[model samples]
Target chain A: MTADHLRREEWAVTLPSLGWLLALFAAPTLLVFAVSFRPADPYGGIGAGWTLATLREMARTPLGPVIARTVRLSALTTAICLALAIPCGTCLARVAPRRQAVLLLLVVVPFWTSFLIRVFAWRMLLHPEGPLKRVLVTVGLADPHTQLLYSEPAVLLVMVYTFLPFAILPIYAAAEKFDLALLEAARDLGAGPWGAFVKVFLPGIGRGVLTATLMVLIPALGSYVIPDLVGGPGQDMLGNRIAQRAFSDRNLPQASALSAALTLAALAPMALAALVQRRPPALEAAARKEAA
Target chain B: MRRSRWPPVVTAAVLVFLWLPIAVLAANSFNRSRFGSSWEGLSLRWYRALLADADTWRALRNSLVVGVGATLTSLALGTSAAVALHRHRSRLQRLHYALVYSPLVVPDLLMGMSLLVLFVALGADLGLGTVYLAHTTFCVSYVAMVVLARLQDFDPSILEAARDLGAGRWTVVRRVLLPLLAPGLAAAGLLAFTLSIDDFVITFFVAGPGATTLPVRVYSMIKHSRNLPAINALSVLMLAATFTAVRASRRLLQEDRP
Candidate 1:
């Protein structure tokens, strides 16, 4: 009725894995964190000496506006992606099983190609004389040459397109595992459809929501590609701004400061993911397994 | 529950909407006279132009080097970690698993930037090597997570039986462990290749003077001239190549799915 206590031998196999991860993955990040506190070059005050100036400088500058824009765009993208994905997952989960698999494959088809090509395809769509332009002109929405590329809306659209798969995949996983009877129970207990969903179904999808929000938020925020090319020159975000300072401005100090800000910002979702995964349900499963 | 076509209808519509830009770019690639989208007639002239372009070749080579290099590194590091973790159940095993998952959670930009700083402080030359290191750091974790998921139901008893039947650790591993884990390893490796080839953010941050990737080149072109036929042709070519590989990988993984 139980695993052999001689399973102690298994511990021998697993220890080195912890060592390997710590050495390779954890060590590198530790190095990054350590170096972040060091001065990039010390011309401003400490003369290439150690300084809090970098961390302090994070709050200053048009950096606030820059980061705010990045967060806003990323949040909007996450909301839109989830908004589309939730119903999409519900559809897939509730559909006939054979048909649902085909639909899921279809949703994931775009993920089959390079992300670069997918984003580039959008370029073709929004081009001046492109089909979209032709359609718009045909329908008389705007002029033939009205620029669609390099705008905030374009950036948002690309973000949604790129991340929509991320949202759907996790939510679909959750829905597949969802106990529909609880939802029916809620409905049976004088709850309307909306109430049933809010009270019974939402909690079942909680982990999926967290995972999808997380998956969307991290990339959407630091994404240099969509915002840089699609959002254009003036739409400089944290990523674009950092790349600009590093490559264009060649200001390593400023870039270092920007990099530190980005690292802290990236930690937000990561920390939340860590917290969620350690929650009672997941931890209880692990603990129960250990007790067995 | 009554089924609704509205959900599927909306989903299909959204997908088409998503593909609009791709359709536009691909459709325009064949337009005889490019200059954005002045369609004279259907022709493969732009693809010919794409094939002939020097920068295109250079970028393609750069992307291949980065992709192959990063994939190899990730497989080596990631597979080792997955194997170790698969065998290693400890007090902090869940935390250990989450540690491997951290790279998945971090933004590519942060990883790129942090690597840039880390390499700089070490006085390491900023080049393709640094780029590979950065790419490997993030990709290895993804590979580990995927592989580990595939390992959940795997039986350790087979290894014990092989050992009891007079096999050494290496022999048991070579004959028993590797064969069972082979499909998962292949999937992880293929996924890493796909991710590395498609990567823009991390590579953008960590690449040096000569490490200009295809996406970077294409990105600049999009910024300057939004409707270049060569870019469209290149996208189509890349799409074709990726589809072929993805299909092949799918077959390889699926065949082992008994």
Candidate 2:
């Protein structure tokens, strides 16, 4: 086929999905942004005129605290996931190939199961009258009346559990491709063991660390189920408030505002990363030479 | 070449943290007690109750219908997009790539909420049809990603060879491309199906009255119902289904690697 024929064929093949996403994904996402600027009708619909009232409302005390709590918890979850995943990925990379496959599969199994069911499992385990509480009481580590479910720590714990695999897989993928001999080379160059690790090993897998952070942080920030099932009223995150506005409160414009804020917040770091990546080639080359 | 012991120790501890809840859930599925606070004894009563629950079965049926619909639709859309993406380079393709990729990064809740707003604005009644649409939107992105990864290692010379052998355009696609793409298609289909059936947050927003999927049903049951053990039993069965599907997809992908 000629290049023109191939181009026509490509357009033919691409148009269907392109149209579908444009209608459902792109248009709807833009609608969310547009609706955020509109006024909420008292009857659970968008009003005739547009205004910035919803955006300003987001800065008020009620939603402000939820946003803060969401960011804090998500940041904590990302940090904890990184700390655990770095070591875990390093070990998986160091293991024999056959064993590495099995270990990776183990990590993926829980992730494949239903998200709701996993959260429910945590609920069952952390139930006030459940076996865990019984064991803790038996070990004298907790009083009989102590609660495990519907607490901030429980929310954090489950958030970590839910997002841990996401962190591990990317780090493991990057680590698997990483050359371990570099560590030894650094050590031979008279760097201390810790120094070698901090300087060489971490930088070698830096891409994975960034990928893992984004993976964990994005989902953890938008998490609705974990906080809903495990967190009490005081621990409500932005997701919970968005859900509340959309469903219970029937405030569509407010929900859109919250959703828009969240979409922007999630995309900000990615945009920053892209900007950093688009630096001048000369600068990149200079940085490469410096590293060498 | 000496390995530090701390990494393995942390891995084991993290694995335990991951598996303990699942183990507890599976074990309690067979518990005779209603609350499952403590096991009275091992019994299949909860499983029996779960089997006999009409609402649960109906929800599962709904999930399967939506899953099959979404998977087939996404496979067609995603495979075509992947092929076009792999073969072509242009500003339009870049835009297409961004559209295909954004869903993967956007939060599920936002996707659901935005779609809900769209439907509301269009005066479209929410139902299983809306749920199917919402599921297909995200599933297409996943299927495209998988198929694109498969396409990365594919050789274009195979298609040229078929054409050089006097095969028509349709014949070459039928005889060469489809066969070569079958494993990828199958893997992507399984993944899409798994994701569609397992989805909750999206379905939760789009589903109308009498359009409840399994996850939505289970969420309400967990929130309200007294039958905790039956939910446990249901979760175990769902977990088993997920394991089989994921394993099969992995095997297909592994077999395709040459």
Candidate 3:
């Protein structure tokens, strides 16, 4: 086929998908950007007036606690997921090929279930009078009547549970490509364990770390259900607030602005991941060449 | 060689943490206690109740319709995009990937919120149709991502060889490319179906009255009522379906891998 013919074919193949995305995905996002700047109607519909007031109103709204709590929880969740997933990924990468597949299957199978149900399951398990609570009491971790549900810790636990697979998947993908000999070489060159990890191991898996961070942090920040079912009303996150402003209160403009703010927050990690993901290939290829 | 003991221990512990709640849910589904506080005895009464509820069946029907509709549409769009990206390598492909992946990063709350606003702006009715559209929008990204990954390792010369035999472009795609892509298509289809069925936030915003999905129904049931057994039974059934679909797709993809 001629170059022009292939190019024409490419466009032909791409147009339908791109057009669908542009219409349903991209344009709708732009609409959100536009709608965020519009004034709210008296009754709940959007009005004609255009202003920056809605955007600025995000500052004055009492969203500080929610934002702070969300960031704190997301940070903790991301940290825990990273801590756990890194080892899991390392284990996965080091295992035999058959064992690796089985382990991965085990990791991924639970995620196939409804995430909502999984979260609800956590609610049941953490119920003040549930079996898990009984187990905890019997194990002497807590006295009977100790409330495990409707608490901050429950939200954090569920978030970590829900997002651990996300962290582990990318980390495992990156770690699979890792050259284990590099770690040995670093250690043989008189580097201490911590030094080997910091200089060689960490940099080798930087892309995975970045990907896992973005995967865990963004979703953890936007999570509402965990908090709603487990954390109670006082523990509302950015997601709950946005849902409330839009659905319950019928306040679209403020909700739009909050959504925009959330998009900004989530975008930060995505931007970092994109940068990390792009740069690693060039660096790795160069390293491979040098080693050869 | 010194073996690190912590990795397996930590991994197993994390796995336990992950499955413990699910195990609780599964076990509680069979427990007779209304609160699942204690296992009085094993019973299928909750399952009987779940099976008997008309609303449950209606919601299940809606979820199935939505799942099927979204998956089919997403497979079409996502496969095309994957094929295009695979065939056309350029700087623009990076932009395509970013655009394709944008929905994955965009919080569901925002994705749903924005679409709700857009629908209102367009004066579109919020119903099963809107839910399908919203599900399709996000699901396409997942499908595209999965298919694109599969295509990365695909050999392009097969298409050329087929074309060299005087096959038309459509014939080459149909006779050769589609066969190779079948596993990816199946995986993407199942992924999209599962995602659509489990989606709550997006459906919550787009669904109008009389269009409740299973997740939305379960949420309301949890909020409005205290009975946990029926919901547990329903969740277990959904879980079983999801597990079967995922296993089937994984088997397909695994068998095709070189």
Candidate 4:
């Protein structure tokens, strides 16, 4: 009714969520950073005091390969998703407006289904005696003994499959807003279709491309289930190791250290983008726009 | 200008790639086979087995309980946060915005691990309660985002008009605001429920030995290759539910549009 009342109402509304998040989200994130410095007790608990021992141990541990592998796999997944999504998004954008909603729903239905189920489906499809393997073998594309399950390529393939919709939606959102006349103009200026696509269409949807990359890349980096289910021992990513430390080794501090490293790695590109352009990364901006 | 065939070809290929595995899984759910490597014949034996499995039922129950609890909690918190965020502009709200937004971007693994550490530090037991807490943490952000989007098209004058007509603040909210926000809230609630129920990574970390959600149960079943056909059956059911919920949410949102 009044300014004072409105301000009070705002605070009243804000405080509950603010307190909840602070207690749960903020405090826990800070706790991860704090615990990363603490010692791991032998009995699956944090030790009494703080130490750099965990960080020092992490430095000496052979995490380089895992980190490198995580980045490589995630980057590859993002690249592949982008390549596939560009055309898919372009096609969706060009579809009849009435059919666009149905097609988008088709894309989203698989995404909204249980993530584990999708990953499990991949496991089934890639099974040694599965139909896919049998078909490939029959076509002389694979040795009969060769398994499609449990390999780096398997992980990459599933990751691309899993995150492809994420990439496509954002690109489609951007492409839908793009002007078609620009392409015609580019063609009129003597550019071939390929040149017009590369020169005009790509730049036109640059924000969407950036958004799609981050959407795919960030989740791929933090992926645990994909690599664990479909990947071999040699394909352990940072996520797998982080889970192993917490669940198997019961090393809380080490797990915290790993999680902290992952949090930084995930946020690094976003922060870097923000710094370079003096604006929030397109992912966050796109999210806000989507929310609005 | 002539239309290139590349877009349609690529689109079809990608769409098939997306749906093939799901279609295979759905088809195999009816397969009267043990391994699900090949189809024997169309039958509902796996579905019957899934119904007979007590463990799957228990996990599904746990998922429903957590899902409903998290959805209700996040709806209240997220709706309030969204309304406050939409109306207010200040440094504190900006900080609140960051708090709300960060959870959306933070990796589930990190969020799960961090919460596990926090629970361990606080000596809280890992169980469904912890999973509920963990889920509400992220669900609130999603709910807020959805509500905020709904609020973007809202007209503040309607509220002013109600107030001028001698409606009290609560009356205005109850009579006008809540009705207008109902669609957004329902969509947000459905989304929250779906996310909470389908969540595995976070629930995996926070859930005690006794507190297995459906996804976690499905994960172990997949790992052990136990009753593979039954998992297919359950996957099909869950997928059906997800699709229905998504469609319902879309319909609600579309109906809300002028």
Native contacts retained by candidate 4: 0.86
Off by over 4 Å in 3: A1-4, A274-292
Best by lDDT: 4
Q: What does the lDDT read for residue B12 in candidate 1?
A: 74
Error at A222, model 1, angstroms: 1.2
User: Which of the predicted structures, 1 or 2, would earn the higher TM-score when compared with the native?
Assistant: 2
Off by over 4 Å in 2: A56-61, A276-284, A287-292, B256-258
| DockQ-superior candidate, 1 or 4 | 4
- Ranking by DockQ, best first? 4, 2, 3, 1
What is the interface RMSD, in angstroms, for predicted model 4? 0.9
Kept native contacts, as fractions per model, are 0.51, 0.74, 0.71, 0.86
Compared with the true structure, all predictions reach lDDT values of 0.74, 0.90, 0.86, 0.92
- Which lDDT value does model 2 have at B108? 89
- Best prediction by TM-score: 2
Segments of candidate 4 deviating more than 4 angstroms? A1-3, A276-292
Deviating ranges (above 4 Å) for candidate 1: A1-47, A55-60, A143-147, A270-292, B36-38, B91-95, B224-227
TM-score of each: 0.87, 0.97, 0.95, 0.96
Clashes of each: 4, 0, 0, 0
Two-chain complex of model 3, DockQ on C-alpha atoms against the true structure = 0.75
